[model samples]
Target: MTYTTRADFMSGLREALGRNNIPDARDILIDFDQHFDGGAAAGESEADVCAKLGDVDEIVKQYISETDGRFTEAQKETPVQETVITDNEPEKNMNTGDFAQTAKEASAPEIKNERSGPSAGGIVGVIFMDIFLFSWTLITLLSLIISLYAVTIAFAASGIAIFVGAIMIAAVGAAGFISTGFAPISLIFCGIMMCAFGGMLVIASIAATRGFINLIIAVINLNARRFTGHNVCRKIGRKYREERD
Candidate 1:
């Protein structure tokens, strides 16, 4: 009943709103304080004031019932989330309760992010990222294998082309000496076709090399992400927290 210190109010609020809450919980506390102060100034005893308002639990119910009860989009962004890794601990997936409980805890009576917007560490985003990384790794490995095969095939075809071209020119020379123009014409066409094929093989080989290079880059990026990605996401999270507050 004693309208004591801020801590006392906070304790009551915590019991009301719960431990896990978004940043909007802070705003709610501020509002509660203002309400209590107004009531006290209206000639009511401190105990009466407390009793009239009722238990912190009831207050929270009323608070939550409001249309815009608590929370802002900015505040809801990861107000409370922990990376729960079970070091090979049964590898269980998260259930709905985990999230609901987390939200309840994060919301403090003193301050809470009650925005009720999307989850900060959305399961959807996590799933998508997982899928992307897995697919990329698979693709990179496959492309590398294909690139090697392409290059080998090109080299083999180059060897065959050189041999055939040589034979064609020799045949054309013999035709000219025998006074027959048909053989030389056919040989010239064959030479052109062989050269075209060889050029296409070279192009395919080059393309494969480029694809392999891309695969290597993807792998490198994934490795470096453990460091860079952590800090970047942390910084972003902090910024959103401040905005919610």
Candidate 2:
């Protein structure tokens, strides 16, 4: 079901856990509640948080499977043996061979399956790419954006100055204090055109700046995932797209 509010989402999760007979349902609900609070603090909506969490049934199934696996592992580690005592049989004592076998089993080394992360070569490659390629490209784009904003400001100031100067010239000419070599009306029109151009540049600069910022963020996230072995941004982007669709 689509959860539109925190209450609805939590209620559904709690109901699902209850139906599944989850022993730690209260603890699971508490974790989910904290997740909602964190999302709210980050300025996310309830619907968004729910979407990121995916379906309640799927979450319950995941927990059920994990709990079952834990139980299975525990059972394997502590196998049960039934002892039958009859009046016809005598108690058997442990021999030297049996004691030695038990001791050897007890002292045996345990081999664990460890998960390995990115190799040294892979880390070095990511570092090289970030330093030599991504860094320079981002720097160049930032510089260009700054220059565009500066030019936009310059154009706007120049336009306003030209417009005011034309008005002043016309006023002085009418008073016979100064000779107006060029038509003040034409100068005013030129000033208006410059202002319009500057306005257009302002819009373009804003769009370019946003695009540059997104690009930089993408590069940084990509490099981070390469070095850390966790694609956090990718997961977020995937969840966002899923919700949007």
lDDT of 1 by residue, 1-245 (tens): 23344445545665445444434554455555556568768966556666666666656666556645467666556333222222111112112223322333233322222222334443354345547764675577577667766666765566566557656766766876545446545655565666576677667666655544443443333333332331111111122233222
lDDT of 2 at 10: 72
* TM-score, candidate number 2: 0.45
Q: Per-model C-alpha lDDT, please?
A: 0.47, 0.61
- Against the true structure, whose lDDT is highest? 2
Q: Ten residues in a row with the worst lDDT in model 1?
A: 230-239
Error of 1 at 48 (Å): 49
Residue pairs with backbone atoms closer than 3 Å in model 2 (clashes): none
RMSD of each: 17.0, 23.9
Candidate 1 structure lDDT: 0.47
Q: How does each model score on TM-score?
A: 0.29, 0.45
